[model samples]
Target: MQKLLASCIFFMLLAFGSCTQESDTPILVSTEDLLFVGGDKVRISGRLLTNQDVLATDHGFLFSTESSFAGAQTLSLGQKNGPGRFIGESTGFKIGQTYFAKAFAEINGQRIEGDVVELKTLTPSVSSFTPTYASAGNEMVIQGKNFPQGTKVFFGTQEAQVLQNLFESKLTIRIPVAAGQVVVPVKLVIQDKEIVLPQPFEYQAGKYTKVSEFPAQARIYDNTFFTNSSGFHVGLGRLRLSDSYRSFQRFDPTNGTWTEINFPGNPRRFAFASSSYLGGGALEVDRDVFQFDRSFYKINGSSFERLPDLPFNTREAMAVDWNGKLFLFGGRDGAGSVVREYDAIGRTWSQKRPAPFDMSGTTAVFKYGERIYVLAASGQVWEYLPSQDSWLTRGTYPGNTGQGFPFAQVIGKKAYLGLYRRTQEIWELDLETGVWKSKNQIIGLPQSINAGHFQSNGMIYILRSAEESTNGVLPMELYKFEPDAI
Candidate 1:
């Protein structure tokens, strides 16, 4: 009986010691509140409560989108030799998402998880937007989420007028007139936090205003008009049956008068002319048939001097002056789609890449900044980079392609296109944004299809051409277009 009593006492003491050892294990005690919650990050804090005898290999916070700890993301505060308080942090959390977190500890090859804490992240994002190009007083809608009340919007440095119907997901603001043509960031300030959009917004720069009429000249079509450093020149087109003009005229904007000059060349038709002295003289004897001018010329003083011939003969070709060289685009040499570059400095001709599509008919070529743009008869717009020798199809022309002849001239990053069919409604294209807007119309302008057009300074000069009249009598008129006059 004494032996039995001794064994029972020993077993009870062993059991009590085991209970004490298990109770001394590390425990996770979380703080009542989170440290911080903003942006896409969160800060959590907690304490590991235990005696100095227990070891905590690792202590941190476990977070997850779900309430359970399975597949939760772990953020380690660090290893602790004994019980102590710890602060943990995590980033890259999704905006506007709710998350659950708990303090965790690894003790003696076993995991101990603390009580769960709910956390919701603050997310601000813009899903989609519209009206990348807008004039002042135009309403623009920005679609997003988490926009606080009393949010402020700005285009560049100009503050836009926010409308009354502003909501958390949608904002309506009027564009400010002070906006410039430059590509600028759109800023949205919500709750003292500023968010800038990835894509930039552009302000329309140009508007049309009718100026003085062109001094009297033979109303003719299919003529070549070019602008040089000296002044504007107009010449060479069908005046009547079996008759074409061999005379060239110079017009000084200051004097506003056309002075006839001697031009030595055969009566050419559908010839291309550039801003400088280089001009293409037609070699085709017949206008109705497919006859292209393989030869080109340069105007020296009052005379036309012939230059080296092109690789292929083409008529109605589009050409532009880029960096002291002439870039010739598609025209008709049996449906010509060829592109050639003529370097006046080297006096050599080399072929570049062809147009994206055939430019057989009347094509308008203009230069905006460093890039050369071509508007084909098919209403396709293309931009050419001279340095890279590359071509990019910007977009299709949003106007009537069937109109007699399309006119385009670039003024300060804006291309003014006009003379569409019989309508004098001019359209302005934001070259930076590729957005088109209709401007003021040119009233009292004739319905002539083929007018000679050129741009100098801020003025666009249109030389009136003879219409398809039964008696072959056309008015000789010229008009000047000013963009900012309005």
Candidate 2:
């Protein structure tokens, strides 16, 4: 019985040893994972396993377009010692194409391969483009990943000029011509596949129509303009030195014509005016001789009803109306820092808090909602709460406030500002957010100065006069500006 048991144990041990020999390998290679994939490159992670320490004569990876490893390209790592994890990288692959890869190890004289892995190179993609609004020849940047060579970009049907491509990612391009369209879609084509950008690109949109020339054929400077349901009125300014014009005219949009309106006041210049009130300008007593006019008046239809003269001899003051009261800010001739309030209902004037800076004819002021904004010469925008009679710095103006005299016209929630004297640049300010965006420069003489600006029916009308040093007679052209028109 003992001898038979021994013989059985020996047979069992022999069988076990044979099974182990059939299953075990000296050096086993496995394709573990794909580290990374790019438009033309890939990184492969692999591992070598062994029951005992072993040396491989050569090891690395094999890549092929076929799954059967036919006509494969070899990436030989030469030799490796022991069993562990290894990584290999390869490039020069076609983008958006599928390829097969596997890890390999040469043991003794025989080559062994791991499991095959399927990899597809990434295609080009677009995440975003900057300067949502741009004009022809403007530089725009596109940000994304896996951008391959020979990638084409299009703005609508027009192809944009690609300036630079950095690291197969960011693309800098020059905007194409507008192609007579205001807004266009951006598209990218890579490897015969097209991708439309998420957001449509808008060409700089602003339409300026020459409505008419100043009716008098003379440029008015230091003028006061106001708008009401009656019409757009212009009065109280000098057509030339010492020759102030008291000829108030109204431009009727319905008739598209200008007609004379009666204003019972002395010939004045540098007056403060608003939709509701007009007052406090310098009266031209003689040639180049002036005296501060303390006269004040309230508008009723096409005429002005006289009111008691202002206590202060204010001229060129920034006047705005809010909550049925007129708030007069710093004036160049009178107190340059005092804030005066007038109640139209009570027919009384009272003094309020002082302004932060000196005000003049060129100070840009506008009202939106319950607040009033003043653009200072320093490019800083200050806000004033009429109810609280307090002031706070809002933000900085981005455009050049060249020589001040920047004019603003509010339509809805947006205020279009920045036609600073001699500059054609215009910017749109969102009164709700205090954010600003640039619009197309006015298509007019940059040497001209903005004499007055007013809005009607969501459209802005700009009056530009020639500079004092201009040689030819430049007409005070009236331009109808459509801020959002293409």
In the range 1-486, model 1's lDDT, one tens digit per residue, is 322443355456556556677654324444434888854568877766544456778888888999876788989866777766678778767657799988878887787766687889886778877788655678888888766556789888889888853446788888876543446788897655688987887654444443434344355456777777667787777664547777777877777766787666566777787765445546445555544556668865445688777666667777777888888877765446688888898888888876667764366778888888877666678888988888899887776665536788878888887665665656778898988775555645455564566678777876655455535444556677776543
Worst 10 residues of 2 by lDDT: 1-10
- Candidate 2 per-residue lDDT over residues 1-486, each given as its tens digit: 322443355456546655677444344577878889988788897777664567789999999999988999888887889877789988878888999999999987988788788999998777878988878899999999998666789999999988988988999999998877777889988766788988889887778888988785877777888888888888768875447777787888777899888778887888988888999888667676669888999887578999988887887898887888898988774577788899888788999888888777767888888899888766788888988989999898899888888888889999888888768898988888988888888887778888777888878998888786786867788899998886
Q: TM-score winner among the candidates?
A: 2
Measured against the true structure, the TM-scores of the candidates, in listed sequence, are: 0.55, 0.76
State the TM-score for model 2: 0.76
Question: For residue 102, what is the lDDT in candidate 1?
Answer: 83
What are the runs in model 1 whose C-alpha is more than 4 Å off?
1-217, 277-287, 290-294, 300-303, 470-474
- Predictions in order: lDDT: 0.69, 0.83
Off by over 4 Å in 2: 1-94, 100-119, 126-129, 179-185, 198-202, 284-289
CA RMSD of each candidate after superposition: 15.0, 9.0
Clash pairs (backbone) in predicted model 2: none
Number of backbone collisions per candidate:
5, 0
